[model samples]
Target: MQTNQTYDLLTQVQRIASGDESAFASLFYQFGPRLHSYLTGITKSETAEEELVQNTFIRLAASFPVDRNSKSFRLDLPGGQQ
Candidate 1:
């Protein structure tokens, strides 16, 4: 990932760790449509794509990053589209 993109993600992750729901919403709004489109292209099935996106985000939330080092989950999903 680019430095700028990584910084933005870390910013959001930090906010999320601090109990910022708006930051998480910002993440979803910024990435959700693009994820749906990408998943749809790969899966070629609306139902499957939707399910995959939902599952992916669910898994992402379950692995929240706690700090910049060590505890981070190294989220590179879709090459840092968010």
Candidate 2:
């Protein structure tokens, strides 16, 4: 079950790399709230959480390649990528 979940996540990421807006939006919708909550907990500021979440996604998008060769990849965001 866990492995299947991981595979699904990778597929979503691949869709993102392929310039799928819906896929990116899905990722945002799926992860954004959790990320915001976690960030707010750590920073104790709503504004900071918002900024961190944006920065994290920006960094992830910037760092990832369109033609990634690896089947599995990990991105190390500052507060993590949700």
Candidate 3:
């Protein structure tokens, strides 16, 4: 079951890397609620959670050609810092 879910997520990430808007939307809908809940718990602020979620997706979309080979998630930080 975990393997299947991982494969499916990889597929979605690949599609997203190819600039498929709907794939990105699908991922957003799939994880949005859970991400919101987690963020809310960590930040204890609905507004912050919402903003963080939005920023996260924006970063994901902006980081194209998602590296499937890399085990660690990487988002290019501000000021060109990795």
Query: How are the candidates ranked when ordered by lDDT, highest leading?
Result: 3, 2, 1
lDDT of 3 by residue, 1-82 (tens): 5999999999998877765667777888888788988987799988888788878877777778655564434343232223
User: Best to worst by TM-score, what's the order?
Assistant: 2, 3, 1
Judge candidate 1 against the unseen true structure and give its global Cα lDDT, from 0 to 1.
0.70
- Supply candidate 2's per-residue lDDT for 45: 86
Candidate lDDT scores, in order, read: 0.70, 0.72, 0.73
Question: Tens-digit lDDT track for model 2 on 1-82?
Answer: 4999889989998887866656666787788789998887699988888888878777767666766453443333434443
User: Candidate 3 versus the native: TM-score?
Assistant: 0.73
The C-alpha RMSD in Å for every predicted model, in order, reads: 7.9, 7.2, 7.8
TM-score of each: 0.67, 0.74, 0.73
**Residue 67, candidate 1: alpha-carbon lDDT:** 49
- Give the worst 10-residue stretch by lDDT in candidate 1: 73-82
Off by over 4 Å in 1: 65-82
Clashes of each: 0, 0, 0
| Candidate 3 least-lDDT 10 residues | 73-82
Model 1: per-residue lDDT, tens digit, 1-82? Answer: 8999999999997887765667767787788899999887699898888778767776766677464443344333343332
Comparing 1 with 3 on TM-score, the higher-scoring candidate is: 3
Candidate 2 — which residues are off by over 4 angstroms?
A: 67-82
